[model samples]
Each structure stands twice: as structure tokens, then as C-alpha cells.
Target: MSPELYITAGAALAAVVVVILLFKAVWRVAEPNEALIISGLGARRRGGDVDSLGFKIITGKGAAVMPGFQAARRLRLDTRAANLQVSCVTQQGIPVHIRGVVIYKVGDDFASIANAARRFLDQQDFMTSAIHELFTGHLRSIIGNLTIEDLILNRERLTSETRASAADEMSKLGLVVDSLQIQEIDDETGYIVNLGKPHAARVAATARIAQAQRDQEATEAEQVAAANMAAARRDARIKEAAYQAEIDRAQATSRQAGPLSEATARQEVVVQETRAAELEAQLAEQRLQSQVRKPADAKAYETRTLSQAERDARIAQAEGEAQATRTRGLADADAARALGLAQAEASQAKGLAQAQAISARAQALKDNQEAVIAQQLAERWPEIVEAGAKAFGGVDHMVVLNGAQGVEEMLAKALTLGGAGLGLARVLLNGNTPNDSNSENGLKATESRE
Candidate 1:
């Protein structure tokens, strides 16, 4: 029973394995990056007549291929890259060798798939060589139309030119170019290098100039910031010093407060004591005035009154004696005058004889006025000396520095002043002499009395 069962199971398992192998061969699956190109028989046509290739294209799914009746081939649609090297001349007629890479993929559309399948299905490994050869001619054309400057710097112009030069050719190959990159440009005559030299030098110089300016501005800003920092530090130090000074002053004032207060209190006590002393002295003075001065003043007044009355009595007694003497003298003069009148008649005859002699002497004196003035000066010499001595009357003390000589000089100066008066008298006497000689004699006597 086990042998029969084992043989049956073995046969069934082999059949299933063969069927699976057969199904895998007929049922062709297209991967994400590939397309199934089925042709030969019962294959549906796709795209229009212009692009139809009597084949059916399937992508991203499976299709039943009838083995001999219909044949299916896998066409790769993945990206492929090709290296390109070309010798070309730029629009500026500069010869250059360019090296580049072109990235491309088979088209996803049915028409493009059919075209690629027809061309590359048998030679999938030769795709890169085909693309490289094709792109090489297109790159030459592109470089011929563009300047080295555009190729080197203007990437957009380079890309656009590449697209314009290769688009139709790539479409015929059923390939889409994702990118064309120019990797290197070798200038045989150094045309491209020389062309950029001036611009490069100018740009380098401008960059250096800008860098220098920026450096200078940065230095100035740094210096200004340092100055500001120094100023801030100095201000802070000044404020700190001022605050310290204020603190010291406050401390000193606080330390002295107690002593100053005590001194003020002592001064107030002294002032109060002084006021009390002054009030006591004033009270003493008032007591002295009331107890002593009033009584002393009254006693002195009484003494002065008694002395005045005694002096008045003595003056009245002396006045009465003077009146009695004057009355007796008048009586004696009346008697003498009566006796002189009897003798006056006898003297009248003698006076007439004396007048004749005096007239002769007056004529001689008038004839010599100098001799008259000299005689008069001799007669008034004693009176002149007395008048000169009166100059010293009010002096309390006489101190002559030159001793007796000084006293003599002073007396001489006083006598000189008296002589000046004598000259004046002489001038008066001279005017009076012609009119009245007796009047001149009387003026001389008055001068002596003065």
C-alpha cells in the first residue's frame, strides 16, 4: 500500500513542476524597467501606421506569449550613460577637444518602445556604444555653434544647444536624454584660457579691493568699540571715586556729630551764664544810683548854694567902699582945680613964651621926619616890649629845643611883629603932622597904650 501511494504522489509532484516551468516560459512578465516586445503572430499593433512595427508592447505586467506562434523579447527601459569625446571648433573658430557624458533612457511610449525593440532587441549590450557614437556627432555640432565662454560658463546655453542638436536624432533612436554634461574642454591653442584671463584678473583684483575695504572698515569699527569701552571704564571709575568720596565725607560727619552736639550744648550754657552775670552787673549799677549818687549830688548842691551867698555878701561890701573912695577923690579934685585957676593966669604969660620956643622945635622936627620917628620909638620902647611879651600868654609849657638861643629867637620874632605895627603908626603920624601936630602927639600916645 505504501509503494503504490508513493509512486502516485511522485508522479503528481513531477507533473506540477513541469506545468509551472511551462507556464513561466509562455507567460512573459515585463519588469518595471523593461518592456515585453511580442511579435510573430496574434500580436496587437499599437501606435499609428507611421510608428507601427507589427508588434505588441507590454510594460509592468505579464502577457501570454504562444512560444513559436508569438515571440516576446525583453527591452530595457532603464537609464543608460555613455561617455563622449569629440574634437570640435567653437563659434569663435577656436579648436578644442571636449569630453562629456550623456545620460538616456528608452522611451516609455509604445511607439518609442517598438522602435527601440526593433533596433536594439538583438544587441542590448551595444546600446552605450550606439549612444556614444550618436552623441559625439551632436556634441560637435553643439560646440560649433557655441563659443568657449558659453560652453564653459553658460550652462543653460550649452544644455539648450545640446537639446537642439540631438533632439531629433535621439527621437529617431527612441531614446530620451535626461542630461548631457560637458566634463572637460582641452584647448589646443589656449584660446579658452587666454579668453578668460583678463576677466579672471579683473575679478581677482576687484575681490582683493573689496576684501581690503572690508578689513579697513572692520578695523575702524574695532577701534571705535575699544574707545567706547575705555570711555565707559573711565566713567565708571569716576563715579566710583565720587561715591567713595561721598562715603568718606558722610563717615567723617557721623564721627564728629556727638562732639559737635556737646560743644553746642556747652556754648549755650556759657552764653546763659554770661547773660546772668550781665543782669547782675546792671542790677548793681541801679542799686548804686539809688543808694549813693542821689544823696551825694544833693549835699554838693547845698554846699555850692551857701558858698555863692557868702561871695555875694563880700562883693556888696567892696562895692560900697569903692563908692566912698570915688566921692572923696571928687571933692579933693574940686579944691585942687580952684587953686590951679589962680595960678593959670600967671602961667598964661609964661606959656606964651614956651609956645614960641615949641614952635621953633616943631619946625626943626618937621624938617627932619626920621629924627622925629626915632624919638617917638625911644619913648614907646617899654610899651613895645610889653606888647611883644603877650605872645607867650596861652602856652602851658615852654620847651625850647635850642635852649636860651631858641628863646631869644622867639622873642626877636615877637619884637619884629611889634615893629611892623610901629611902621604903620609912623605912616599915620606923617599924614597927621601937616594938619595938626597935637593930634600926631595924641596918636603916638594911643599907640603906646595899645
Candidate 2:
């Protein structure tokens, strides 16, 4: 194991390292997302009947390219985006703004790779700009054929149709569209906003009607409940009155029975006393009996006479009262009938006077509408000025460029809008016919409608 054996081992290791470096320098790898385009010298590829394409495209593998005779270039096969912002006019002559993105990549087939390599091998950085221009023109064309509604609601149609439109062109450029999306559309006019207003108003009207119906139903229910409570109160009062009448009648009966019972009890006592006297003294019995009998008969006769007189008096008084009530009823009926006729006549005369006055006033107004307006405006001038001044209530700042003159002009302009009410009043007073004569007063009428 001396110096000669060591020299032999060192030479073998040097040869192996040189061969590995040479292999690394000659071999080129194409990544999964890229294709290597090899041109010059034996780089031609042969397919079935067609001859070689004059170049070789290697994808996802390694190939040997001679250092001087062959040139290898990479064409990326990864996806790319081309943004399109186009202001285009639709088929309906409507201007629209569209923003979208087109996702594209180089085709995977050999033929597509050949086409791409031939054009983009040296200019891969500008590929997106070229696609952007291509797709921008295509989008304009596509948008020109479809309407705004189609663009908004039928985006899938737009996509498919756009892809179909640019299919041949993209194939020539060796591009395949993975997705074409229309992201935004801006309409300059407010057609879409006004479109839903009618439906919204109808829905609002229906809601209001439903709310009113519910309120009316609630009000009716409340009224019915109030009626029921009042009826209960009335019935309770009637029942109490009936019970009170029964109590009063019972009390009157008790009061009437007291005097009769007292009279009967005194008569019984007198009879007992007479009987006792008869038993005690037989001699005086006859005398006492006569005296008691005579006095009792006299008292009885007086009571009978008084009762007959009182009955006669009550009968006469009742008869007189009935006669007076009947006379008064007859007189009242006659008086009421006369009063009714008088009132009817008075009402008729009053109605005729009112009708005449209304006719006269109407004639005057039709003849002198200007006078009527002048009178109304004169009466309500202060209120009109106050209402016009309310327009600036929310203003926190005021800038007058022309001092008092500017203030006057601003005030006049603001009052003009509020003067719509005055215009409406004049329109009402006149029969839609305006008379423009110079006012006797210095004030001039700047606005008038005829």
C-alpha cells in the first residue's frame, strides 16, 4: 500500500467525479408545471404520419441537450389570470361597465406545446398582457351581443358563449381557458332601482290595508265589550229597583196594619170591662150595659158617617183630577201640532234664504276671482311668510356673497318652493284661467300660470 496504489485510487475517483459533472451539465429537467422547449440539432420530434416539428418539448421528465448544438428554453404550463375591465355597450344600446378575470394556461397536448413554444419561448413574461388584450376584445364583442339583463341574470350563458367565441383564437395561441367569470356589472342608469318601486308600493299598500282592517276589528271588539258591560250595569240597576219596590211595599203594609190592630184591641178591652161589671153588681148591670151600648152605638154612627163623607170626597177629587188631566192633554196636543207647522214653515224660509245667499256668493266669486284671491292673500300674508321662513330652520351656516342683496335673493328662491301652496290656492280660486293685470299695489307677481 504505497504511493503508486494511492495514485491509482485517486485517478479513479477523479474520473468518476468528472463523469457525474458532465452528466449534470448535459441533462435538463422540465418541472411538473413547465415544458422545456429544445431547439437546434437533433431536437426534432417524429409523430405518426406527420414529420418532425423541428423541435422537442419535454414535460415532467429529463432530456439531454448538447451544450452548443441544442438550446433549451422553458415555457411555463401553470395557470395565469388576465383581468378585463371593459366599458362596453350592450345589444340594447345600453352602456355598461364590466370587470372580470380569465383563468388560462398553456394547453397540455404536444401540438399545443409546439405552438406555444414557437411563439412564447422567448417572451413568456408578456404572455398575460397578450391574453389580456385578446380577451378584452372578445369580451367587448360578447357584451355587444347580450343585454344588461342577460349579463346580470344569465352569467353562465355569457361564460359559455364567450368561451365558444374565443375557442379557435385561443387554440391558435395554445391556451386553454379553465374558467371565464364575469365578476361585476355597473349600470349607469337607475332603471333597476325604479324597476322594483312599483312592486314595493303595491306591497306597502297591501300592508297598510291589512293594518287598517286589524285596527277596525279591534275597535269593533272594544265597542262590543263596552256594550256588554253597559247592559250588565243596566240589568243590575233594574234588578235592584225591583227588589227595592218589593221592600217598600212590604214596609207600607206593615205601617197600615198598626192602626187597625190598635183599634180592634181597644174594642176587645171595652167588652171585657162591661162583662166584669155585670158579674160584680147585678143591679147596676142593666144601667151600665145601656150606657155602654148607647155610647158604642153613637161612636159607631159617627165613624160610619165620617167614612162615607171621606169616600165621597175622594171620589169627587179623583174625578176632578181626571178631567183636568184630559183637558191639559187635549190642549198640549193642539199646541204641539201648531208649533210643528210653524217650525216647518220657518225651516223652509231659512233654507230658501241660504240657497239664495250661496248662489249670490258663487256668482260673485266666478266674476271676481282676482278679488277673492287678493282678499285671501291679504288675510293670510303673515302665515305665508312664516311658513316660507321655515325652510332654513336646519341651516347652521350662512354665506352671503352680495350682502343684503344676496340675502334677499336667497330668501326669495327658498320661498318660491314653499309658494307652491300659494299657486295651488290661486289655481283653486280661478277656474284654471289666470288674469295678468298690473297690480294697483307696487308689489309685482313674478310667477303666474295660465
Candidate 3:
């Protein structure tokens, strides 16, 4: 090689080594889990806005940081867990020991990174101690607000409340909590143990209840399956029996088909014969009624009619005789009554004037005989009419073949009896006892009525 070429090569190599050294001095790269906070002379943003981050934040990229002018700090963004043990008072005022862990990381945002770089960039190794101290205070504060039961039972609630309470402070510290876990809570007064005892008992009881419900469901399922199986078997047997009975019935019916058919035919024939017999009997009955019974009935009706007519005639005769007899007896009774009245009047007049009383009465009766009779007839009019009506009182029904004429004749006969009574009264008023004449007259009236 030539000397000049060697000198040129040395200069180029020296230039490359210088560039590499400068790059080594100025270049800064942030890992995926880290943020690079470059601060110093040129770290300010464009236009030099006072509100802009004084330090440049780079994440997952390379940045040129001038040595001794711009200082680059790597803020680890990877999660860090800080174990914390603190003694705090719960909401119930029971003093408890709480051991907890806080998983935290540096914020990704420029402001958060700037804040974290400002606070913890110098000593990243002390982050755990800082987080531990920070979480101890936070745990104490949060646990003071929370009951032992809340702490024991509701971890989510406790974590949320803790995050909320520490959010602003952690923002200032440029840290974000990924998880806040309460590892253990110890109660020196046995409050936690006692509290867990009841919960444990309830959990055990609930488990037992669930188990019993499952057992009961299983038992019920078994019983239902058994009953269903039994029912299925019974139904199968019943169906078999029914099928057997149907088969037997079908065979029996097949065997008896001929006989039954014959019997049916015979039954139809018998029915027809019976109907014919009934028709024949009806014909005979009609023939008998027309030929013999009808004529006999007609003859019997004629005989009965003749006998009834004769009986009616006899009854009429007897009734007329009885009416005449009654009318005559009534006339005689009226005459007797008139005699008694006359005697009584005579006796009364005798008391007033004994002499000539009979003569005076006889004279008065002779002079006003018609007036006396009129008065007596008027007074006895109702009685006379009633006596006349008695003639037909015993007759339930009188079928008058002569129609209205016969009715008129019976009325005339009754009126004749009434006239006879009047005649007898007139005879009595005339001071003549017309016994034989009235009797003969009554007999003549009865004969005429008959």
C-alpha cells in the first residue's frame, strides 16, 4: 500500500471513530418499558414556550442528548411492586395491621414522565422505597375509612377507594397504580377471626343448602323417573290386557258371527211375524167391533136408553106425585096453621072481648076473604116458590128429549103445584076444610102431570 493512501485511510478511520464516539456520547434510546427524559440546555420545545415541558421525553425511540448540556434519564415504565405493612384503625375504630402490595409504574404521558424524571430520575433504585412509603400512607388513610368487613369481603371496593384517594397524589408523583392489593389484615382483638367465623358459617351453611337442594332435586328426579317407569309399565300392561281382550272379543265375535247372523235374521222374521200378529189382532178387533161388538153395543145402548127412558118416566111420575103430595101436605099444613092462628087470634080476642069473637072473625074473614088470602099469599110467596122448586131438587140431570117444550112442561107442572097450594089457601080462608076435595084435586093434578 502507498504511504499517502495509508495516511488518508487513517484520517477517514479517525473521522469514523470520532463520529462513533460522538454518537455514543449523544445518542439515547428508550426501551419499550422505559421513558427517556432529556433535560438541560436544548431540552426545551420549539418556540420556547414557557408552558412546554422543559425536558424532552422520548419513549421507545432514540434521541440525541448532548453530553454535559442535555442529560438523559431513563425512567423505567415497567411495573414495580412495593410491599407495605401498616397499622391502621378501621371505620369500626378497631386497630388492625394491614399488609399490602402496590404495583405501580411511571406514567407514559410527557407531563407524567417529566414529573417522574423531576422527582425520581436521580435514583430510580429508590422507587420501591418511595412507592412503599407512599402506599403505607395511602393504605392507612383508606383503611381508616373502611370497616374490617369491607376490607375482608370487598377487595374491589377497597382497591377503588384506595386508587381514588391516591390518584391526585400519585399524579403529582408521576406514578400510576396497576394494582393495589391488601395481602393480609390482622386483628389483634380477634375481630377479624370472629367476623370470619360467621361468614364461614354462612358459607358452609349455603354450601350445605346448595348440596341439600341438589340432593333433593336428585331424589325427586329419581322418584319421578321411578314413577314414570312404573306408570309406563302399568300402561303397557293395561294396553296389553286391552289388546288381549280385544283379540278375544274379536275371536268370539268371529265364532259367533254365523249364529248371531242367523239369530238376527230370525229376530227380523219374528219381528215381522209379531207385527203381522198385531195387525191380525187389530183386524179381528175391528171386525168384532164392526160385526158383533158394535151391534151389541148399539143394542145395549138402545136397551139402556129404553130402560132409562122408562125409569125417567117412572121417576117423573113419582116426582110429580111426590110434588103433588107435598103441595097438598103444604096446603093442609097451611090450613092447619091458619086454624091455629085463628084459634090463637080468637083466644087473644076473647081476652079482649069473650062474647061474639068467633062471629066477628068469621064475619071479617067473609067480608075480606080475598084480601086475607092476598095477604097470606104475598107473605108466603117465597115459601111457595121454594116448595115448588123442591120438586126438581133431587134431579141431578134431566135430559129433556122434548127440548124447550119439556122444560116448559116441567115448569108448568111446578107452577100447577104452586096454584094448587094457593087454591087450598083460599079454601082455608073461606072457612071450609077442603080435605077430600083438595086431596082429589091433588090426585088429579099428579095424574095430569104424569
Show model 2 residue runs off by greater than 4 Å.
48-50, 196-450
Count the clashes in each prediction. Answer: 0, 0, 0
lDDT of each: 0.77, 0.76, 0.76
Please, what are the lDDT tens digits per residue for candidate 1 over residues 1-450?
799999999999999999999998889889999998888887876556533467788899999999889988889999998888899899999899988888899998876777788788999878899988887777787778888878888866776777777888778878899988878898999887888889999999999999999999999999999999999999999999999999999999999999999999999999998797667557655654564445545655565666678888978866775675455446666765654553454345445445555666667656876666655554555566568778788889766565444555576687667567666766776676565557445544654443
In model 2, the worst 10-residue window by lDDT is 441-450
**lDDT (0-100) at residue 347 of candidate 1?**
45
Best candidate according to TM-score: 1
- Candidate 3 regions exceeding 4 Å error are 1-33, 39-56, 59-61, 66-71, 87-95, 109-111, 141-146, 150-172, 199-225, 252-450
Q: What is the C-alpha lDDT profile of model 3 across 71-102, one tens digit per residue?
A: 87778888888888899899899999988889
Looking at candidate 3, the ten consecutive residues that score lowest on lDDT are 346-355
> What is the C-alpha local distance difference test score of candidate 3?
0.76
Stretch of 10 with least lDDT, candidate 1: 342-351
Better of 1 and 3 by TM-score: 1
C-alpha TM-scores of all predictions: 0.58, 0.45, 0.45
In what order do the candidates fall by lDDT, top score first? 1, 3, 2
